[model samples]
Target: MVSLSLGELISSHRSRRNLSLSDLAEMSGVSKSTLSSIESGETKRPSYTTWKKIADAMDIAPSTIINAFVDTTYHPKTLEIVLAEVIREGWEALVAKVAIRYLESPRIDTFRALDHIDGTARDTENKRIKRILCDSIITFTRSRGIPSYLASALYERYLIERDDFSRFEETYRRGKELLLYTEHLYTEDRIDYYYKMGVHANILGLHDESIELCRLGLREDRTDSKQKASAYISLFNSCVYFGDIHVAAIYLKEYENSQYADFRKNHFRATLLAKKGQHEEAIELFRVCLQEAKKEGRISIVVDLMASYLEAGKTDELLRLIESEDQFLPEATPQHPYRMKTLAQYYRRKALCLISLEKFDQGFHSLSESIKYFKQLGTTSEVIDGIRLFLRHHRTNNKNLSFKNMEILEDICDNII
Candidate 1:
């Protein structure tokens, strides 16, 4: 599904009704500030009363917003962009076509199209022309179901660079299917396809699927322990997502002793500890991971381990590291481990941290951001409950919004083509 960003969904609904945020806020008994935050995904969890009021005010079944929030992986942003594009282009048929494709193909086809770029260099090597021709031929073959594994592989890479994983799982599905149907398509071609998908699934909160796919590679491919171990570690990470700490422990143990482990085991081990409520120990473990990864010259791994250290509340270590200012740090920091699931959780936790630090606005901002991503990702039901409560407490004044506006908006959304 084309996930609509939180901003897009709320704005579209507001715009079509010709209702201002202030107007809606007034009618729903929601505070303007709170409504803005909820609309923006900042206040990650709205209280029960808050959402009920917004639902009641908007005349939308509280269930529509509630269900939208619970669907966890709903395509809110996708819907937003398509809606906006339709509005811009005045192509109602195109909008309809996209919606149909969205519901039908949903994942793979969308990623392929979104990630498709041309006249770009995959590598700057001696066979530049060959890579270009290969990408072209691959794209063409995959389009017609000709088992062009290379094309699918290239498309997967494109998705990674762009960070557009709305259809991540779908691409993995299509790529895997093609590989299965055409054994000849199995070259050691797209290790990243497997690895990145594992990462994306972890981010999106599909931990089981993530680990399972990694296992598919570890068992099926000729990768050595190094590669296999990462895949295994990925599976270990998923155990946390599914909320089975003991299972995570079992997998963490496996990863810790793996011949494939390259000091990165420290971070993974620490992650398991943190999840198991051994937070203090986990913090120390990740500190060692940071040092070891730095020692091993694994830039990406070091960045990752550092993030884990930061997340697990290894505060003193973070402070000391900050004071020391490792001049050799990467240009950018790594994101939280899951990057997929629990985005709102990240914001919620961050907000708590900010609150503890007495940074009220910053804390609120963090929570609001969390709320937004949660809305985007369709957070857990517990989160939706909170959002609803927050909204009901809000006292917006716009009591009557016309369905005519919403209809106009949907028509505009349908014109994205």
Candidate 2:
């Protein structure tokens, strides 16, 4: 059944009964103005006695209306479903339509919807709706005049889905600014916000900031076991990135001791093992991690596991792994927010595998493709890292195949730098 606003549902039932607002008011003993206010959504939460009177007048169950409001407030999926229905019904009331759009398209679609709403002149019927819609959209899009807890949640989602680091940084700054002014964040919300901020900082190579954020999350008195585990993991990763393997190992042990150990913990352990030069064990663990991630349809984790393979210098094994998995093609576009970064890594690994097999021309071609993606992402860091990996491998194994290609690689690196 379609979910409707309390007012809309009440109005529909009253219309079906062929009763005017005045007639309903007369029967329910509610004033005509009160009935009109409720019907127009100007009064959302009526007194229970008033609601019961209205329900009695309409000859429907009061519980149904209560449940509808509860579901809309607490269940996001229910709200999304209701929004889909509202959109399908072509509700032209600006506030309802804007709410529908917000639920339907939290990201890009809502931006376009806001633009449309702004361009259209406000009518008398829509003035109130427009004000509410504009406030909500501004809170989300501009990250201003919004509650800190809500702004943090929205920004976290946006940051996680954004591919461009610059854009992600902008959103992060705005979220941080909003959060600074927020005074009433619940413990859970604060923990979640700090965790997301830590992860984002780690991704942007701000290891110290990430470590601090994770520590802050861990220090919260009311953090749950799951949140503590997550904070520990984040701290471990940040330390690892900062080249403090010992400290990372300590946090990793804490994470392992937590009740939340899972495939993620295993994956991090594999990374640590690889960093410690335990290639055989690390490769085995990564293999298991990849299988589990693939089973869960977490393709991003699978791709990341392949990077671990590269780090472990398992080029032949990585190539074999790629060939065995139909989903592990070098040319396919990844669905992750870090699509270009992942793609670059994939091609870089593929090139290293090909180079180790004495296929200079094909390997260089792959390397060039990796460079192209890195260029598109406005970063030469990955390309430089890939080049260094290639140089290290060439010095060890492929020295006889390519002094000429080494010159080309050096030239490419020089130009980019």
Candidate 3:
């Protein structure tokens, strides 16, 4: 597509705004002589600060002011020149929209462009705007599965939100690395990081680390309901994981009036019931939760309900639940992280059910499949757990099974890791 020159863009916007060179100079704080030089094509590459002042004076994005100079392929160059300006002028939201639009172009290396913008804005003084812009770029990168350090942190958050514990240990470590890049993280992002890392730590059996992380999130000020909800949920779960039911209950009560109280409250209440040995009540609550989650089409919760049922020894019911969901095809979209996670857990649950029913061969094959899925999913922790689970069941059920098959399953699990 043919594009206007930077000089033409600036002159056109200035004319449309009905501002003379002197008037523009007065509004933008740029000398009329320099404005004339830019508009007349004498100053071909005005500094970012100058372009920003003019864009601000014209009530336009710096990108709009210089769009003529930025083709789809040169979009990052535009960002590199003005990201700091965009942040300093509190135009993060506007510029982020522009950047996202540029990302939609198929010819661009969008991830590399975002990375470039990040690097260019590294020294920008406004932390709040920097944080906002950082979140935008990282969020885009994460949703597209583009690998970058910040995007990886958000990906871990995504995994935790989906209740995928397959990589909890690695997630915790990566979250620590994420902390080192905190200069550009907003308060909400920090809260999200702490709570998510806290959950991962809790899953890794690092109770103290989890508690500290949750406390850090709670200590952040000006948190809204959703943010506070996350912190509270993290604290409650951490306490429960540590067997501090009293503390967990206290945290739970603290959020009883939350907007999320119904689903969140009931889910944890069921957990508390299970912990208190009220199996039937817990199972009933989970069944209700399962129905609600299904009605809402909450796949993560559905998968979680399957795990809860299996934990409660409702094997047949769990199998039936899995079978009933046509949407639970884990192998359908391997590129989708949530589906892949669900697939791993789905097969793992199926294997456990088969083993319990003394379907030894089918159970071993399913276990092998689960381990393979977890390995392909790059979750070392899940792979190890799968191996240990196989070993435990194999030891118990070996006499009733073919020795060669067991050996093959062991080799399959071992070879993948």
Candidate 4:
């Protein structure tokens, strides 16, 4: 038998019984406004008691009404089924169409659906889908005034994905303009926006801004344990980058004391040790964190652990870590901006190790490959870091460098930076 939406079923049954909404409101003792909302699909999931009252007034079983109303609407199960299908099938045109339709609904499920669709679109480099999803979100938000946080979240992410920081800075200004109005946001959305935007700001090297946003999130009294933990972690990262080591240590300690402490704590501890000039202890902890992160499928942190080894001046260990991680490395596609940055860093570290070992030709080529990946990202800070790496090496190895090699390095730096 065909299924119907809650609204459709209610409207059809009421019509067959020749009951106006006024009559139903009087018979069911539910308010006319509420009854109208139910029939119009504005109130998708009224409480069981409400549904029961309406069902009893119509001389029907609540179970029959509930079962018959299960259809492809804004129910949680419908969202789950659509997400599962999208995951199973890969993002096809049909899936994209259905995803857009589902995302246009003004519900929490619609927010979740948009997140899933946006993730797949980013992975697959589906810019069209991303734009469409953003438009759909804008339309829904304008119409409903709910899920407002998604506009900032998705727009910031889209800008970050393309490494378009010029536009991002403008967006950031607009975001700051909205900060005073954030009291209108749902608590969960407020916390989530702060956490995400804080992390994004940190990644983009806006450490002060990152710290400010994360602190705002932490100040929200209604934040849950997970939300608070996330805020603390973001604060810790920003403090570390902002060179406020004392504050970073405090945040780390707070996270360690929290119930959410896990392998991530080891990673943060390793970072702290590295900052304090305790390279040996940091390296050991990094090794443990790398293993655990790999087991947990945290690819991003695994790359970071590799960088930690490089930063500690353990070139030999860094090389070995790269080789060992070859099998597990995700494909570094130009389409995937974050992966491109990761590979750029990976290759840059490998090039440094090779150069330190006197493998000139291979090292130069590896460095070139690293620069190529960084160029695709349209980012300059990382490219400047690569140039600094060359300069530092050249200073120490001046005698080892052939005059021709020095010219090549200068040319690379001048051309890029």
The number of the candidate with the highest TM-score is 3
lDDT of 2 by residue, 257-322 (tens): 877777777787888887787867877887777667644333445565666677766676667766
TM-scores of all predicted structures: 0.43, 0.48, 0.51, 0.51
What is the lDDT ranking, best to worst?
A: 3, 4, 2, 1
RMSD in angstroms between candidate 2 and the native structure over all alpha carbons = 14.4
RMSD of 1: 21.8
Model 1 stretches with alpha carbons more than 4 Å out: 1-145, 148-182, 190-192, 245-247, 257-260, 277-280, 283-348, 355-359, 368-417
lDDT by residue (18-85, candidate 4, tens digit) is 99888988998999999889888788777656776888898875445544433334555464455444
* Residue 333 C-alpha lDDT in model 3: 46
Residue range with the least summed lDDT across 10 consecutive positions in model 3: 155-164
**Predicted candidate 1 versus true structure: per-residue lDDT over 31-80, tens digit per residue:** 89888887788876555456557768877643345434323332434543
| True lDDT of residue 390, candidate 1 | 31
Q: Where's the lowest-lDDT run of ten residues in candidate 2?
A: 119-128
Candidate 1, lDDT over the whole model: 0.52
Q: Number of the top candidate by lDDT?
A: 3
Query: How accurate locally, in lDDT, is each candidate?
Result: 0.52, 0.61, 0.65, 0.64
lDDT of 2: 0.61
- How accurate locally is residue 92 in candidate 4, as Cα lDDT from 0 to 100? 45
lDDT (Cα, tens digit) per residue for candidate 3, span 1-417: 345665686778877978798998999899999999988988876765687688788887554654543332334445554444555567655556545555554556766666555664454556555455556666676578555446443533443333433444454565575665544567666677777667556545567787888788778745446756766776787788778999999989976856755575777788788778777788788777666654433444555566667667777787787677674353254654434555667778778877888887777788877777767655677788987888888787655446876676566566453
Error of 4 at 146 (Å): 15
Ranking by TM-score: 3, 4, 2, 1
Worst 10 residues of 4 by lDDT: 161-170
